[model samples]
Target: MMFLVIAVISTSIISTSLLPNESSHIPFLNDDNFLDWKDQILLTLGCMDLDLALRVDEPPEPTNESFAAKKNAYDKWERSNRLSLMLIKSHISQSIRGSISLSDKVKNYMRAIEKKFVSSDKALASNLMNKLSGMKHNNSKSA
Candidate 1:
């Protein structure tokens, strides 16, 4: 079952490049929009069939006996990593870019962003809770 799923995903990634032009309307990320930008960027990566690059920590090393198969896997991994990095860099605003240099690997880049913005999941949850609690609800009926 796992092998079947991997095969289907591999096929999909290969065919993604051959499809007609599809615009990924990703929004640019700035200081004040990290959360929204993260959500949109994730969606864009999924649309491009490159979300796996961000999730994977490292690609499996090719075995010596299966050189050709290993080479193909390595090539695909490299392509996905490169595409992930490019997509992320393209969406970041100049001001934020000036503060930190992005890593070449997609996983590292994502970790860096998370570390800079939230530091920890607990902290992020607390921050969000505070924001939510501070909201002022105006009692007005709208059409």
Candidate 2:
């Protein structure tokens, strides 16, 4: 029983540490899954760069005004769009799990997302913004 308890504790620590931290405000681009899983991060990172360029030279850092302003309806709409993409991404990941090679999986997912973007609701733009912020793309020189 004592051995079981220690093992469980150690396992919990390792697993929890391995899971993504959603509240860290760090972008998802640098994650192993993001790095090896797909090219979607590149698109997301590019969009973020464009959005920030439009806003100003620098990307929007966490601030009171920006955070409060993003609470508007447009923000909600944007968030929804990102969520939809994430859902689709999750599905793609599950579908290809342990079957497709990493590069192929990424390529396939990217193609699928491009298609989905055309039909996606615009309200989810905020979510796109959120996804783009932390994305570190292999070819991206902007950040």
Candidate 3:
């Protein structure tokens, strides 16, 4: 009885400490909610201290003869990239998950979303303009 309780408590503590708390509750992304989802994803990444993974490109790989400093920098970037990829994959919608290849990197995932949703800032602005231009006011119903 006492042994069982101790085992359970120790397991709980170790498991909780090993995984990030923020990752357990992130919003899932879907096609219809890309704009809102992107904002939330960015916010969550920032909170996890992993925002740099998305903002910056991956560092170049170090050669065998490279200095310790360069190798260390590359290792840090690689870890960040892996973590960011995991987080991004975790939050992606099930419907879209099948489409994103397993080999896709974090930056590729982000760019895929941008390509599917935005393409470019200018393109998004143009799309919005076209929609607004098509709107018709029902002046007969209200002032």
Q: TM-score: which candidate is best? A: 3
Task: Report, for all candidates in order, the number of backbone clashes.
Answer: 0, 13, 0
User: Worst ten-residue run, lDDT, model 3?
Assistant: 17-26
Report how far residue 138 has shifted in candidate 3, in Å. Answer: 12
Local distance difference test values of all predictions, in order: 0.76, 0.43, 0.74
Candidate 3 structure quality by residue, lDDT tens digits, 40-135 = 667666665666767777778899999999898788777777887887788888888776556546777788766766545567789899999999
Which order, best to worst by lDDT? Answer: 1, 3, 2
Tens digit of lDDT per residue, candidate 1, span 1-143? 99999999998776566443344446787756788889877877776677777776566767777679777877777788898888788898887766665578888887788777765556778989999999998999899
Model 3 lDDT on a 0 to 1 scale: 0.74
TM-score sort, best first: 3, 1, 2
Off by over 4 Å in 3: 1-25, 101-103, 119-143
Tell how far residue 32 is off in model 1, in angstroms: 1.5
- Stretches of candidate 2 above 4 Å error? 1-12, 24-104, 122-143
Best by lDDT: 1
TM-score of each: 0.61, 0.22, 0.62
Error of 3 at 29 (Å): 0.8
Root mean square deviation (Cα) for candidate 2: 20.8
Q: What TM-score should be assigned to candidate 1?
A: 0.61
